[model samples]
Target: MTGKIYIIGLGPGPAGWLTPEASAALEKVTDLIGYFTYVDRIPPRDGLTIHGSDNRVELDRSRHALQLACEGKIVGVVSGGDPGVFAMAAAVLEALEHGPQEWRALDIEVLPGISAMQAAAARLGAPLGGDFCAISLSDNLKPWSLIERRLQAASDGDFVLALYNPASKARPKQIFDAFALLRKLRPAQTPVAFARAVGRPDERIVLTTLGEADPGVADMSTLVMIGATTTHLIERPEGRPFVLTPRSYEANR
Candidate 1:
């Protein structure tokens, strides 16, 4: 009997957002492996072993998870947000393809969960309701030059942008550079949303314009969405305003 490995997405940092499928998979796994922060999200349970590793060792983590599964331990590899979106699913698949041949025989499944961009869009009332694209600002695996090119092209196309890993301790300037590049190409009043710790207790949102938005306000937990020119805000005197991109394309025609 070969134990299978499941790659589960925990949604955007909240228990409520976890999908029923992901929750069910978690219940069956004997071991949960992920980054330290993500592994911490799983509540302590009987008969479960938790393995946490540093942020940079995703391939190593995938290898270990596959190894455990081959040993007949049902293993769960967890990632916050959707594992497929700038997360662990691709890494696991890549590792499996290049790793020891035995891993190919093990059962591997990727369970979906809410991605940060989707959660952020929900809270912002659909800035990505139409054509949009997400780009990660981190250049860990890819080059910074490629990131800059994508940013410039996204700006040029006027596509709604959802930025992931916007700013961290080491890569702070990339966000600033992204903003500067976008500001030059986009209008001053173009709506930009900064959503932090979304779906969690400490969640906060700030809406500003391309010219006036400050990159200092964002950190690693933040998902920055730059709205299309067609996007607009609906003001509410007593609550958070609704921001949306209308579904109509009459303006473009």
Candidate 2:
């Protein structure tokens, strides 16, 4: 019997946001594996076991999850944000393929959840309605040069961009480089939104412009939203802060 391995995204951090399907998957899993902080968010489920680890040990954690699945133990690997976007899905898949031949027969499924970019865009209101792209500034896995090229392409294409893993302890200058590239193609006044600790108790969303969105606004947990060429600032009639991205299709007519 082949064991099933599930990569599940827990969303930002409120249990109420967990989907019924995800919750049901959680209920069926014999073992849960994820970063320590994310594991703490899940409520205790009957007959579920957990494997938690510090954030630094990605390879070790992936191996552990694969091992459990190989042993015919249903495994659920959790990630806080959407598994596909700068999360565990890639790492888990990479490990399974490269680690050993034993992992070839294991059944692996990736389930999606609310990404921080989607959640933050909702708070800003229609900043990504038209054509858009998402990029992660962290160069831990990919080279910084490739990240720069993506930034330039998105900027030149006038695609609203959602940035994840903007900055981290080791690579503090990544956001700065991204900002420079965007500024070259995008106007300095292009609206940008920085969301920190999104959906959590201490959530903070700041509205600013490209020139004003310095590296100070970024950290490991921050997500950045950059508006498109048609995107502009709009003050809510009720005096709230936000921005709007107008669809280019409207201009064609």
Candidate 3:
């Protein structure tokens, strides 16, 4: 008998952020597969088997999960944030599409959870309250030129930008280059937020303007939000300021 496969999103970091649906799915799976960090988050049980691989081998991990499911083991391919957003769901689907015909007939479900961008937006005020777009700064799978074009288009269209994978040890310069480009396109005073390790123990949220924003504060874990021209901040007496992008654009017209 063919078993099932679930693409589960574990949310950003804290266990509380995990959705009820994803939790329930996790309980049913006989095996879990994912990147080492995310797979390590699951507690070991007697009947459940966990497979952890390197961060860059998403396709191989998906194939292994599919093979296990074909052998009648219920499998869970886990991801940190929402699996559909630059995570394992797409990888699993890609595997299914190219794998043997029997693999296609196996049961598969994608369980959604809170994404990093959403978590970051919540930690701040409502920076994504209006029109917005998310762009992954990592050019491992795609060209940097494409990313630049998308960034320019989003800026020109006045959409709030949620930038993922802003910087890493290997690709540190892209974020700075991106900042330079945004500086040319956007106003100096436009709000920019650096939300790092959000929802985790070491969470840090920094709010600044485009001209004053510091790119060095970001890493692989940070989600950088560049505000539209309409985005602004509200000062509070007690805590950090609130960042907001208005939903209506009547004033701009």
State the C-alpha lDDT per candidate: 0.90, 0.84, 0.92
lDDT string for model 3 (1-253, tens) is 5799999999998989999999888898999999999989898888899898998898899999999999999999999999999888999999999999999899999999899999999989999989999999999999999999999999889999999999999999999999999999999999999999899989999999999999999999999999998899889998998898888888754
What ranges in model 1 sit over 4 Å off? none
Estimate the TM-score of every prediction. 0.96, 0.93, 0.97
Superior candidate under TM-score, 1 versus 3: 3
Give the residue spans of candidate 3 off by over 4 A: none
Write the residue-wise lDDT of candidate 1 on 109-217 in tens digits. Answer: 9998999998988998878876888999998889988998998888777789999999899888989988988888888998999999899988999988888899989
Q: Least accurate stretch of 10 residues (summed lDDT) in model 1?
A: 244-253
Residue pairs in collision within model 1 = none
Q: Is candidate 2 or candidate 3 better by TM-score?
A: 3
Name the lDDT of candidate 3: 0.92
Where does candidate 2 clash, by residue pair? none
Top candidate (TM-score): 3
Error of 2 at 134 (Å): 0.8
